[model samples]
Target: MNTLFGSNLKYDLKASLVVFLVALPLCLGIAIASGAPPMSGLIAGIVGGIVVGALSGSNVSVSGPAAGLTVIVLDSINSMGTFPLFLATLVIAGLIQLALGIAKAGVIGYYFPHAVIKGMLTAIGLILILKQIPHALGYDVDLMGDQAFLQTDNHNTFSEIWYAIQYYSIGAIPIVLVAMGILILFERPKIKNHKILGVVPGALWAVLSGIIINLAYGVWKPEWQLGGDHLVNIPVLDNLGQIGNLLTFPDFSMIGESTFWIVAATIAIIGSLETLLSIDAADKLDPHKRTTPPSKELVAQGIGNSISGLIGGLPVTAVIVRSSANVASGAKTKMSAVLHGVLLMILVLSIPTILNLIPLSCLAAVLFLVGYKLAKPSIFISIYKNGWDQFIPFIVTVVAILFTDLLVGIGIGMVFGLFFVIKTNFVRSVTLTEMNGNYLLKLQKDVSFLNKALLMKNLSRIPSGSKVIINAQKAQFIDHDIQEVLNDFIASCSDKNISITVEGFKYKIHENI
Candidate 1:
């Protein structure tokens, strides 16, 4: 057990420190955007790291409050009336996720086509880049990690960019440019491969550079100084008891509302889906190529969300941004994730003031790097080469997600993918062969119910008075609708004087002549 984590202590600690640094600003920003107490995001981050990290089967994936669900969460909090009442809905959502895991609903995760998943990730990448521009310019009106097209302040994603350009802080410009330069230099192979220097993540240095630049500005160019609004805003705590004082408990009184269940189910399904997709993406990113058990991941997320909600936190999911950061930072085990969580708890409890000193622009610069990695233009070229069947859905998903929300975009992409599936199946569901005068009909692969009309038409084309042969040996599953059509055709075979022979059918032909 110790070997699973302790074996890579040096590497894990370094990686965890990077992830912790990345998470701190996001936790507070998401909470502010969601209309919940800033501490709620921190709570969710802690639970996601320590609780979900320990319980999850994933080695590289990191869990926390996701920007993908920010719109839904904010709407829920507003519509639900109170933060405690919203917490109740979150608890219910966790319970629903637990039931889904037990029911093996995780299998649904595998059904998402690779094209769609890639599209979703790519869309998120684009959103991150666009949304963070305002923060990077030190506008700081829109909270960090708010991925939706529309902002909490009524400004849409693109409008935020224009607004930031028009109203950006002159003082923030130099800090962001310097931080971004440091980050870009860190990406160089020479620097990245160095033993001692490579050990340090660019994000860490970028943050430090931002702080120092701000300090220098404050000292010399006092007129161009950034205020507290431009920096991280974690609540200051004087003692351990103050932490509990900030915690908000769930209001169980709202359990009887029908609307409560609807909200719960929504969070559960979306959170579970997001977690599953993030796990899949993280596994692909892992250098070791380890696979995570989907069912166990769902169970872990359920437990984490439940605890997070009970103590006032947003719904948690396996966040691709942090997971990708963890992998890029050289995390070896779940221990890194746990350590990040512990550090988050410790920082918020002990040194929140120090954290508050970190600039939002620095975090935005780090996310810009993360976003670039996910949505590199080469990815689009590769997907496009895969042909329209793959590229159409991929492009459609990216566009839909940009205009709408994550789930809606995914649904759009899946629908296009399903159309392709049905089209391909319609063409090959039934195969034909002729032996002398006998006509043979063979069902290939798993014939879907979508092929019923085509199958019936093909069967009708079989000349009357000709012997017919039906083969189901290669079929893994014959849809019940197709089976009924076959049964009806077989029952009328005698009248047409077309004698029929059947092979490899598991079920008896009903009303056989």
Candidate 2:
């Protein structure tokens, strides 16, 4: 563990700090966006980063409140009313995830087609692009930050885009433009040579630029409209004296509500899926190709969520963006994740002012980059190159996801992928020894309706007048459909003056044969 993929404490500390900056606002934004109290996000992030990070076997995978679970969490809180009961559900769901891991259900991921996974990534990319536009353009709808595509008011993703353009503000555009610039310049390898700026992240740069732009708007164009609900405004508490007031505990009375269990299940299922998917991605990204222990991951996640829930935090899971950022930042072990969580706790609880200084728009810029990477063109090209078997499932998944949601899209893709597999296995063959420049096919084993297509194709491919032999040493469960194909072949041989022979096939039970 100390060699190869492992890193020195120096690199891990640097990477953890970088990841901490990257994860902070995301935690707040997703929590705010999910309709939960803004602090719930921070709590989940802290727990995921510190508690789960230490317990998780994953080296690069980072756990926290993910954007993917935002919709579910929002819906759940609204429906359940009593948030504490939801905590109980988190415990139950964690148990389920833990059981799945122990039962060796990690292999369940392999059954998912590559096409479906790509489609999922693409669809999410599209959704992320669609969701962020309102914030990027500076629209100030009351719930503009919520996770549901159509807000609780029934405004779909596209509707929000339309609304944002109609209400687009000039002040917002400049920040995004700077963000765009930061994104571009940071990626160029040549930028590394600039001693001061190299080690610092593009995200920090983009965010700082946004805050500066907002400040300028406030000074010059007082009506630039940068303030209001558009900015992240978590109430700043001064040290340990006020920390208790900032945090809220669950209402224990809701524990008996059946609705609470349902909400918990939703959070657990969605959180587990997203975490597992991220874990899979992290494994692929690991230079050494070390797979994350999935069951262990569930146990860690469960422990984190249970703790987060009890302590007035939102649900938690392994978020892909942070995991990707960790890997990109040269994180080599779970220590980076653990340290990042510790840093988040210290910053939010101890240094609240610095936390508030970071602008929301800057965080949105980071998300834009993450979304783009998730749905890159290169990913599609790679899937297409894998051919139709891979491509069809992938396309189906993408289409399903685009039309429906993540779980539904994956379900549709899996159903079709299974069909394709069964279709491929429908043909059986019999080999033959050379006799007078002709060959024989030995057909045996449960010959059923599945073999019909293959039988017809092979019969047609062979030349007429070619001596053919049928050897069925193990003909059992031979269906009428196969018998019809064999009968046709015999009839065709006679018409073409082709000599044919049959052997080994015996009718043990059927009087009709």
Candidate 3:
């Protein structure tokens, strides 16, 4: 028990700070993208960290506003016509997530194939890099955390890059290049191994550099300054009395609206899937390889989202960027995740002025490295070496995600994965062995309807005068169609002058025939 709280305290504390640095810009950026109050993302981050972290079984996963759900959330808010009504949907979505947790629906995470999971991570990384490019180059027209291919400005991802290239800021360029350089250097073995340098995370250094450089620009070189649009925009709270003004509760009077429930259900399902996938990814990244209990994670997210909605925050999910940063920062337990939430709350309430000085380009540079780490060329090489069966689905998932949304891409990948599964099952359904003057047919585990054709084809190859033994002792399940095929073959056996013996089939000759 002591170890749970105290183990790796130094690492956890440092890592929590790193994650908080990474999450702050994202929280604000996602809110801007979702068309909600910027403070809403902060509230969600606080709730996700403290509330969800307390209940989650994940050791290193960090939950907050996800870029993946920005499109759904934005559309829901616009369609609902009121922010309070959107809050109502969040509350209902939380309840649905709670119910899903109680029903053990989180087992769905385990069903996603490894190839698809890898693809999802790689795709997310690619999207993060592409989306951050504009912000990193001082073009702030696109929100920092927007992950969709299509932007709010009617421009796509590639088009945004062109815009950034055409209108790059000289001041922002140095910050991004320096931050990226520092982050990349910190990842190197020698730099990381340095005792003094190793203690200071590259993200913290990048953020500090951004703040100092911007402050220096204010004193001199005013014409070459980065604008307010390129800085973190944490809302300044004057007093404790004004806090109540910021929190907007859900309107229960809108319970009769059918659109409310539809939006809630969509948020619940999509949020749960994203959370499950993020946790699975986090667990894979955990150095200790500790497995997270998925059901508990859903309940945690439910509570957090409910609180977030009550306080007028956006929907919350386990975000992989923050989670990956948490793990990479040497977090050993959930304490780091919890501490990050606490820090976010403390900073927003007490020191938001200092946090606001952070340049958006610096944060963009940090995320660029995180994205590159997840989608490195080595990852592609490793996946390719696994052969076409795995590589095809992996590559398809990556391409699909790059073109479409996350959920749709995963759906396409799963369908392709299922096709391969069925194909493999069809080929291996039946085994034929030739014995002296006889043929033995053995059915393996769980025969499906797809195997019926293969079974019939194998049965047709038996010699006219040969004796046949059909074995089903090992098969746990036989499809009704397969049983019917076997029954029809048994009835026709006498005419072919073949003596047949059947084992372990419950079907009676008269009833089946």
Candidate 4:
């Protein structure tokens, strides 16, 4: 164990710090957005990182309170009439996830089409860029981690940008600019390769610079100094003993209710889906190309969610944003994820006031770069080159995700992707061709009802006084609808003066025709 973590300690330590910085605001933001106490988000983040990270097979994937579940959390809390009641459902949800893992339902993650996955990644990238613009400009109207198109503040993603433009903060502008500049500079080979400087990730420097800049403003330019909403606001404890006051226990009394079960099932299903998707994405981003066991991931997430809920935390899942940041920060193992959780726990309990001093704009700059990397122009170009079959679904997924929420957008994209699959099968199942004055219709594969329309179209195009051959030698099975269409076509052949020859078909044909 010592050798395993010690070998990559430096990389993991640096990477953990970077992920800690990234996860901090998101935890608070997602909690606030869910109408839950800010501490709940931090607790979930802690559990997600420590519990899930320890149990998961993934090296780079980080689990936490996902922004995707904010709406569900908010609604469940409202309907339950108490946060404790909602916590009860979350515990049940975690147990359901455990059951799903035991049932080997993790294979569902593999069923997602590659186009849709790429689309999801791209969509998230676009969302980060669009969503963070307002924050970068010091517009604190929307929560930091809110990724949906429509905002809780009644402003859509783009509309929020317009609002930000009109009322941009003077104090935040310089901080973000400097932070972004430092981040961009740190990306250069010269700076990144430097032995001493490269030891630290660019995001930390950006955040530290943001803090210093904000403090400098306070001293020399008090009018432009940003505070309150523009900065991180974790609940500070007076001492270690005070931490117990922050914990909220679940109310198991509600478990017998149907509504409780419904909420639990919803959370389990959605959280599992999100976790599977995130882990897949994380694996893709892993430099070593490691694959995480989906079943084990589900089990880990189940345990994490259960523990989080027991302690008054939000439902937990593998989150792509933080995982992406982890991978981007050069994490080598799961130790980074575990250490990040430890940092969150220690810092929140020990020095939350120091964390609160960091600016949101700085984090926005970090996310801006992460988003850029995910949605790079080259990704689109590469996908487009794969032809319309791939590009169409990919673009649809991106657009759908941009307009709708993550699951809804992916569902919409899946519909389009499924259509192409069926269409491809429809074309490959049957073929029609002209030879001299005759026509040959061949069923190359199993023909289903889906091929009925194509068969009809091919049959209708046969000319009068022509001979046609219907070949089904290779087809393993033909649907009843397809058989009916063939029978009708054969019956009409006499009127058109077309002679039909059947080949390799077991079904009875219209011999009289």
Best model number under lDDT: 4
- State the RMSD for candidate 2: 4.7
Query: How does residue 363 of candidate 2 score in lDDT?
Result: 59
Candidate 1 local lDDT, 1-513, one digit each (tens): 677656687678878888898898888878887878988999999999999999999999999998788878989988789999999999989988988888888877788888888888888788878878898898988777677787777879999899999999888888889889998998898987789897777778998998888889888998767877899888887778776788999997878988888888999999999899888878877899898989888889998899999998889999988897788777898888999999998877888777777888888888888788879999999999999989998999999989887878889999998887777777787977777779989998888788888898889888779899899898888888988899999888888898898998877767553
Candidate whose TM-score is highest: 3
Comparing 1 with 2 on lDDT, the higher-scoring candidate is: 1
Per-candidate Cα lDDT values, in order, are 0.86, 0.72, 0.87, 0.91
Q: lDDT at 104 for candidate 4? A: 89
TM-score of 1: 0.87
Per-residue lDDT of 1-513 in model 4, one digit per residue for the tens? 789767799889988998999899999999999999999999999999899999999999999999999999999999898999999999989999998998889999888888888899899989999999989999897898799988997779889999999998988889889988998998898988799999888989999999999999989999988899999998887888888999999998877789999999999999999999888888888989999999999999999989999999999999989998888888999999999999999988888888899989999999998899899999999999998989999999999999988999999999999888888889989899998988999987799988888888888788899999999999999899988888888888888899888998877756664
Error of 1 at 175 (Å): 1.7
Report RMSD (Å) for each prediction in the order shown: 3.6, 4.7, 2.5, 2.7
Q: Tell me which of candidates 1 and 2 scores higher on TM-score.
A: 1
TM-score of each: 0.87, 0.81, 0.92, 0.92
- Model 1 segments more than 4 A misplaced: 1-7, 431-442, 452-472, 476-513
Q: What ranges in model 3 sit over 4 Å off? A: 193-195, 218-221, 433-439, 462-468, 488-501, 508-513
Clashes of each: 0, 4, 0, 0
Better of 1 and 4 by lDDT: 4
Query: On lDDT, who's better, 3 or 4?
Result: 4
